[model samples]
Target chain A: MNTYDDVERTGMSTQDVEETGMSERAVLLDFPGADDLMAAGRVEPPSAQALARALAGIEAAVAAQEAGHAAGRKKGAVATAPLRGMSGRRRALVGLFTAAAVAAGVATYTNTGETPTGTRSETRADTASVFLNDISTVAATQSLSSGKYWKTHLTVGDSYLSKSMDFYVVNDGKAYKKGRQPDWQLGPKDLDWKALNQLTTDPAKLLQLLQTPPRPKSISPFDQALTLLGGSPASPKLRAGLFKAMAGLKGVTLVGTVKDSTGRSGTALEFAEAKSIGRVIVDPKTSSILEYTFTWTAGASKGKATHQTYLSVGFTDKIG
Target chain B: MKPDTRQHEERSDGAPSRDGGSDAQLTRSAAGDAAAFTPLVQAYSPALHGYFARRMPGAADDLLAEAWLQAFAARRTFDPSRGSARGWLFGVARNVLAQHLRRAGRQEAVPGVEITDPWQAVDQRLDAAALAPALRRALAELPVEEREVLLLVSWEQLTPAEAAAAVGIPAGTARSRLHRARGRLRDRLAPTGPAGRHLSVTGDMA
Candidate 1:
């Protein structure tokens, strides 16, 4: 009998016959009792554990922030905590930020429309604050300023991290390799460790370098790499610290509310970008973020992605 | 994942249970109705659990917990226009599973074991004993992809489209896989041994 004879026996449609032919070529294509297996197959959920860990972290941070607030109140040093960027850069113009908050606050901005304006901490000045403004002006005048430096602290979701920079405007300045000590090398090929080290130590020297461009022959590949990492991309969403660094005002954007593991209410916030995109889970009643995450993308190409690495950051109120 | 304890005062049959609307349900849940979400949990939990267990390690409880937590955390991003609430929950849980596996560094193919003797379960309703051994041998011999497609369809009862979704393959691929699998099963059960050398073209009783 012809192979076509079998296909035509049941008077089946041409499409059905073709489908059957394709499947017949592959062994084990049609499994029996697929329904029962699917019904029987079930997996336990893991969100509960993750949520618990996150809540513990949030509680610790909130408690710490409160204690610090209490201590600041006792010292009469303006109990308001300062706002910071993703990299923890404080606003150079605190007075302006405070004025904007006060204006919004006076207007009674609250739960209205899709997004609501919330309360902001009152502003105050310190040595670090004054230094930040100077650095801002330098950065503004020259994209790459010589001998300028700035040190700032940043908080992600609830956990805090630190960043420091000694800015130098090297017209042809070379970058140093990451994690290399200044005394480790010398010569024309080796960048001056003394000058490179100034960004981390001497703010005055850093500022001076910001004013003068470095010789082209002294530039290093390591320095070029650092510039690339710190450089801003085209996408606004990808710039984690851009708005806050430029505006000097950090604010929370409330997307909406969600229920948590304990059957309690919580708020969700989009706090990261494609490279580290994640949502912040916060206790709605307390207005405290219990946990957050940094999402990492992976793929063969730098831009295209195949998988993700979700790094969850749990916080406690005590650490804040 | 906190067991969604919200009490949904609605009936099934794909009908709206409340006079107010779905928005009211969301609002009430958002407003701290811990029990308001109970109906939703109960209804979708079985489906979610079943979906994951068939292919993975069968740790339904743990997977369900993760899925539920993900659904709750991402509730705000849930847009009603795209799909059903249950479907949205599934999407969220799927993402959670991907994250969980990545964190554990245990990304590998965990194939489901084939039931050689369906009668081993001793179910009085099914005469699986007659068909079990042949089915088992046939299944075990099939290629991994084919076996998976077959089991998910016949036993799991997932529609061809849904099965395709789970396996992360196209429905057309799943349909072709199922056909090949069935043909082999039919050939193996056609009674081609010693004394029973009679070919049963009926495609049963090997």
Candidate 2:
């Protein structure tokens, strides 16, 4: 377990406080649904089998655009919208963002190859574990920017509630403590950056670090790993380690390719809960999480289960 | 929250753009540069599919096609200054959903397969999982306005402003509504002194 405790937590910058007009902001108040909201709207990239269909649709869409373009050319449609990120306002926005912001994220205009290849790293690990590890690589490469806050959009796919939500952790030294559930609301109060900075890429050490101070007997190592992966602003190395650890946990098994509610297909990992089947769908190519779902494999809600589809996750310039 | 009569209009439909193709490409697409539009389609299709999938489940693919077709038909109307191309496309999706529901009439609320249990059944395996069923029920019980704002920010990852745009409300109104909704959720999720936390429900947003 790597603890950068030798380094004190970074304090909120004077500029951040003065500009954002916020101080002592602990738990994210505006963005709600840490539990219930995690289960919505992340579209998994097309699967290998669905590739042809998607391509065909893309062709049609392109053709439609072509037709529209031709029509516009014929009609001479003038550029009506704000003239291409060049306005004074856009410049101001661009100004607010320095090299730091550019380093922080790859803006859409500058990003390329956004589509998923539908290819997973060839690994004998649990396909799901491979997926988690793979996605960690994606995050690992992303640059972090110094900003007012760090945000995450995560989907929680539990038995009865499969949900998605956006979570924010300011530079303030507070994180969900390593103990109980409701207590997590009051969990370890420390600098999130410090803990994340202390994260070790080594899966074994990372796993041990995650269980620091120990957790309730009811909480399995799998649960703890998940808590960090889904909750913390962990480095990609840390996220990958968590996935590797998750693969080693009992009851975590490959469930094969599964289509999410949105009809996108990905490899799945399933673990049996007392009353339901806990499932995770992972995009093979990007290693990004597609969905989390818990279906009642038994009991009254047998046919009922909730799922959270993560729309997107990243460190962004804005919190909204 | 009481789910809306017209979900597309009533709920938060500010679907976040994944590929985030620039508005320029959309401009090109409108001008008939079909090639310029390919990336946009590739970028947006999966997310568009998800948008409908949550509402109509398996019908997501077909609805996605219809929405794109409609978008192509009205590509000229897209004004980047007013909003984003994705946001505009989502508005189109909302319209398509509305049209689909209007055609279905009384069956509007029943887009996906109907589950027998009004009470969604879920079993908690560990300490964290225990929170699910409890929150699910409480979520289902919230007012639609608050629920809409909450889900827009929390689930869709929309900024309050984006949620405002998607849900057709003032940004301030969206923020206030989100605040109230969060309050309700906080009361239900972390009750006073860890009382009976497991009560009851999130209506199927799907």
Candidate 3:
């Protein structure tokens, strides 16, 4: 029978169906043999593991919100809470760091035979140095894992230029955009994976490598350092050296703890130049780059910021 | 005849009768009650999970988790006065799917791109299994806007008004699109006999 007959069989006029909702089965009855097609399109329900993970995420999120509310109540003003009320995850991280610092203090005393000094206030420069060094120490301990391809998923947001876009670039022997075709010249440099792999991990030598030609003269040493840290699969030792080299750069300063674009909190370090300012947020515990932001300080694009959030990065056997 | 209030009674406003107390639960959940929110998650997780799985199989779990997280963060913004919570949730899922496809550089899979067929993957599956090719072709030929409305109704089991909420269109517009889509599919699938010929002439007249 024609589709009209099928609808007529439902005993409701088309207008009646529209004004008042039709039954689920009646909705598809107008299309001939749609039941079979709909059945074919059905997929199995979500795995129990997926459901559990989703529930756990919701629980953590709700807990964080509750903690924020409690802190706000105790402080009498909501504004004061953010200053002292870290998320459960961040509080745990702080506790771990405190324990690590005590252990480091004991080691210093045993090795050098001197009493540990009392805590003192630090200048911004000292703070930046100490933070970078802590990240370097963590980075150095990470064991390298290998796979067929090094994949980096990044979301790029430009405040003035255009809308934010997310894209992934994968590198094997050659760089590929979304695992599609070879991207010969990506970013600022004509990236040669072979050359990048052979670069020195010595902090002093890496600093020199970043300063020389083939690295564009216009891009600051700090910006180039971030590009290497973010885009390439640098070994843990190399990553450690890069952070150390950045610690020595003249214009680098700590922006303190801040949340990245994806709302994950991390330590932010800013690098100021003549015409632009650049910032990179790092998850110090894991020594992974969370975000990189660049803002033009002069000319037509002044005050406009470009934020690139590093969503996921790792070596994977397959790319898609 | 008295209008069928059966479907309307279930999904009239922010408070659906089928899942009673959801509106109150949503409000409590927004107020930072995790326990109140657990029921909503348990109720909708299966349907939302299926929604993602059909579109992007491998990344479905991650996408589902991300969608729920985003939904929770923005729960305060959900106004039940406008539409059903279920429809609003599906709207969020649609946006998540679009963002995912865009991130993956799969422009063709992104919705609102009318010319490019978004059903190629689903079509291939049907084709491989030697299932209804004619119906599949008819569906694939429907414009993205109409096909989306139809699928939201047929597959997701949303009412036309609920589908309208999901697609971010007016209820009237969604109904018309549903009407147009069903009409076209009916025409295409009609048997090629004198009856079909007569129906085609009538369709042309309409």
> Which candidate's DockQ is highest?
3
Q: Per-residue lDDT tens digits of candidate 3, residues A2-25?
A: 112223334343556566556444
| Per-residue C-alpha lDDT of model 1 across residues A250-313, encoded as one tens digit per residue | 2223333455444445444343233433444444232223344334443333344222111222
Clashes of each: 99, 37, 0
Query: Can you give the DockQ of every candidate in the order shown?
Result: 0.06, 0.08, 0.14
At residue A39, give the lDDT of candidate 1: 27
What part of the reference interface contacts, as a 0 to 1 fraction, does candidate 1 reproduce?
0.09
Residue-by-residue lDDT tens digits, candidate 3, B1-206: 33434344332122343544666677677544745776777778877887777667676776776667656655655657777788878887786676555544554744445221246565665675466777776676666788788878666667677778877889889889888888777777765544345344534321
Residue A28, model 3: Cα distance from true site in angstroms:
5.6
Ranking by lDDT: 3, 2, 1
Model 2 segments more than 4 A misplaced: A1-33, A39-55, A61-320, B1-21, B106-131, B193-206
Global lDDT scores for all candidate models = 0.35, 0.47, 0.62
- The deviation in Å at residue B162 for candidate 3 is 1.3
Interface RMSD of each: 17.6, 16.0, 14.1
Best-fitting candidate, measured by lDDT? 3
TM-scores for candidates 1 onward, in order: 0.31, 0.38, 0.49
Better of 2 and 3 by TM-score: 3
